[model samples]
Target: MSEIVAVDAEPLDLPLSEPFEIALGTRREASNVLVTVETADGTRGHGEGSPLPPVTGETRTAALETVRAATELLEGEPVEEYRRLTALVRDAFPGMVSATFALETAVLDTYCREREIPLSALFGGPPTTVETDLTVPILPPAEAGERAATAVERGYNRLKLKLGTDVSTDVERVAAVLDAVPNVGLKIDANQGWTPKETVRFADRLADENVRLELIEQPVPASDVTGLADVTRRVDVPIAADEAVFAPQDAVRIVHENAADIINVKPSKSGLLGAADIVSIARGADLELMIGCMLESAVGIHASAHLVAGSGAFRYVDLDGNRLLASDVVPTDDGPGHEIGGPGHGVTPDR
Candidate 1:
């Protein structure tokens, strides 16, 4: 029956090369969890989940516990029923979106290995390459500028800087980055750290100062759809919804409210199927899409990258998960973008 014979999970602390700061909190390391699944015939696979307590409100401990419980529900299940099995894990733990994605990724990896197919084919499209924007966390203008310029030197044309602490300093941060690299593509994510008025003022000030942004993301708190819409209507740049969309219904609600022009889709926000639903909803609503990632490792980043590569539905890609990690196994830097080859998520840590 191609049944699962073993399921296990563990916690890991991925140390960051530098400190990460945002509107919500600061972290020196990413707290993550890993899940491993084995089939009756010795086929095995692994998945990783990264939880940002400040963003998703999911701590690593909680994610680890959820994954442990999910493994109980997954053992003895058929690998061929991967979709159904993932759905069961997702339904059994409604709030554990990141955890369920880990389970789904692990299950799908195992299934693909068993069938000798590519997990990159999960979204029904051929594999593709994506250029990602490395993120500079909220820091002093000079530090932010240095990081942005460094990313540019490493062949990244686009850079995303975290703002929303103070509008004045935030503008200075942008200016510093521009000073470092005049023509680099820039995007800002406030992480729901400001009000609607503050958002409008910030965007207008940037426009007045000749600084251009590709998009302004989630300036207000997640649930404030009215405020989000107000900012979107007021700002010259495109407004993107990030934390505001945690599920398919959340995306539909934001669409109905006209809250955002672009919707940021993260696999950690929903299970794989749910994220796909949101992507379809965005397409149906004529909203632009940006595929995002949490502070994930290669295990999780590779899985999400496969989805992004296979879907090819995004206008923007921010898949640099916790970039300054002490050990990022994938060879993402020193290149314009990342590519996946071979089968079953195609993640090799040769770098």
Candidate 2:
């Protein structure tokens, strides 16, 4: 008989020092869902998903509802069948992709555990570790530079600088960071702050500085495909689609329209299956892919890390959610998060 599985979700409030304000929305803290799935064989798997403001309008209450709905669906079905069910019901609830992803994660974890294999192994494991970049949120130029220096000191070789504040201040922040950490490769995330004209001007300045930025993410508004395409044509640096590319179709469309040179993939925004499809679409379009995450806990971060490790398409990755968290959910018996070696996501939160 097929194993019956159950799932659960809880709302978590982890605070950030300051509210992280972007063009999409403001986040005072990260509200996440902790998902667990179990089988009759007495095996259990776990996952977490951080509902981002851009995808869900920062609706924590709605996110909780979405997860609750997902739980009801998982109560009796075979754990592996979740992806199909999720797709069937997702269109009816357009704003709950993050929640859908949380549920999907639990099922994937259960499937991986049942097979006694790591998630990376299921996707073709990587021989080497996946390296990731550190992110610096928007702050005063001097403070931002210090943060960048700290990241460099911590052995990070790449940095993603959050922009979307004053363009002048943003420029100064970039310069300060580069000055402090000269060897760190830099990427700017405008978070849909600039208009097409402003994006062009900003890109020109970044180029003139000869910083040779890795890419510019979401320089224009999220909904303006034409504007994004226009900016892509004018910018010297590669353009990466973040907020603008949430779905596989979005990735395909952006690539087909030449709106971006790279696509940022986040597992929480796109369910595990959707994220895989997005990566495949990017490869088909010959666009580079980066795996990213919101401020999540070890469970979500580890799951994303395992996915990136298995997918060679990820040229840039951001899996630092564990570091951002004030507390960890990984069991005391689990040792360091990196050591959770098993099938599924290897994520069983202590909670």
Candidate 3:
């Protein structure tokens, strides 16, 4: 309701509790940019961007620079001109998705907070609590199994195992984890590490071993839509497209090719508005939806959780990015494993 006063962007190197390993590589910390928007009325909103080089092809330096540029575009504008500001940022940095997400989130958060409404309400859905799956990063089979068991003990029923090495080793990893927790729901993410042949072989072997899987995510590279479709047809388990679908067009293409049974929506990949478009496309195509997070702090995770809780469209949530952090920017109860409290995303940042 007031004029925008100032915008600030800063880079953060949030340490991870453990090294996060996937098919692409390992990360010991998250490289994120935190953005804050302040209005003339003294109301402020917070946002965060965690750039995954393998996914968004953005480095920390790029995210910081993009946010700085966005700040310049947004300052001196009316607080209500959020759409215009975000559009300008997107146009200026076409591929800087994470930076755009940070700017959009900060502006929207400020608007919602000033209005005393939850962010979910803006999305036209009542806020609802959702459960999240804990990820078991790639490690030795035995070590991976131990981590899975520990997570199950900590009240998590769903476990997402990182795979995509070779077929035999991947099978061993899955088998070991199953041995550790036989009844836990299993979701495997290959992170575009496997080929069509390897995906099929892995699926067939899992069936032979009587390993029931909840889903398999991104078995093939993002560019290989037809190859993903081939794997989807060959496997009994549901296939979710993560890297394969970043925008509405990508979702449409995947649906047209029957490449995947589900689509993963990450706000950082497409910004909040773009994520909404992707969700619309997925719903129109009768595909299931998932809300995932890049390795972000509570600032970003809280924003994403609000979107997921409000839409009520997602069947799966992987918002444990905060759990992997050694410290959080906001006070939250056990990562996103439970509902956050307060207005907006129920978050109050310490700084």
Candidate 4:
């Protein structure tokens, strides 16, 4: 029996120099849930989860409390296998999904380190680097235009723009971005802030703008699966389900209902393992997949990137969390450091 070790959770404030705004919310500060699990052998592993109110109904305070609850169960539980470790926590804290994920990732990291096996090899395939789409926050039309130009200059070929606060404002913002960055591929995320009618109308407008809208994510609320399917049928741009596809069962429904053309997978909302299952389910249906990240550190970004690289299902990726941060801990290695690299999960924060 592996003796239950130490579990600790703390809060950190990572400031984003630029304000990130979308229809669902806005933020200048990023709150991180940092978790560490230690084994009897004195080996310690670190994992991170960002409490995103827009996606998961978890705040920093709540996440910490849940972390505390989860850590209590680590004292003597076996950590040799991911499933056994995950089951121990799930049975204890039945519904605190993000907290469970935070604890699980830390435990998994420790287990992988013990076996000296890279996380990418354990789960998916060999580690491969991927290109990420840079996100452009909602701003005034002129500022959005300038930001778009700046992103293109910085070597980003794909862009994601925040939309759905206002129809006219969203349109003008997209127009400004397109006019400024002519060859860049564009995608918009409404964060489920529009009505079905509004989503349909805006999608038509985007198609008319000659912008080559890659995919519009969660135009309607998460619960409105019917409305989402309607928008998918009405729009020329493919619809991506973000808020709507959180659980494994949600993936099955979307495929059955024809609600989306692409699914955006974020581990914090669905947990690392749960998100992987969702990707497999989507692949079974022949749906395109995009791996996305919240405003997190390279630690969290690297975990998701490992899964993306292993699965070979990612068509578009948005692992640009490092660029949004004030600093990165890991130095540039021969691998895809900015996109993804290193051993298991490749997350070495600049501590």
Candidate of highest lDDT: 3
Worst 10 residues of 3 by lDDT: 333-342
Q: lDDT values of the candidates? A: 0.84, 0.76, 0.86, 0.79
User: Which rank order by TM-score, best down to worst?
Assistant: 3, 1, 4, 2
Give model 1's clash tally. Answer: 0
Candidate topping TM-score: 3
| Candidate 4: residue 344 lDDT (0-100) | 50
How well does candidate 1 match the true structure in TM-score terms? 0.96
* Global local distance difference test of model 3: 0.86
Reference-based TM-score of each model: 0.96, 0.92, 0.97, 0.93
**Arrange candidates by lDDT, highest first: which order?**
3, 1, 4, 2
**What tens-digit string does per-residue lDDT give for candidate 3 at 37-135?**
899999898888888888999988998888887766788888777777777888899888888898899988888888778888877776667678999
Q: Tell me the lDDT of candidate 4.
A: 0.79
Tens digit of per-residue lDDT, candidate 1, span 1-351: 499999888876789888889899888888887778899999887777888776677878888889887777888889989878977887788877778878888888888878877777878766667678899999999999998888888888998899998899999999999999889988999999999999999988988987789999899999789999999998989999999998999999999999999999988887677788998999999999998888887777777777787887888989888466888756555454667654677663332
Residue-pair clash count for candidate 3? 0
By lDDT, is 2 or 4 better? 4
> Per-residue CA lDDT of candidate 2, range 66-157, in tens?
77776665677776675676685466567576677777777777887887778777557742355678778888889889988987877788
Local accuracy of candidate 4 as per-residue lDDT tens digits, 193-222: 899999877877766766578889889999
Instruction: Name the runs in model 3 displaced over 4 angstroms.
Output: none
Q: Report the C-alpha displacement of residue 14, candidate 2, in angstroms.
A: 2.4
The TM-score measured for candidate 2 stands at: 0.92
Name the Cα RMSD for model 3.
1.4
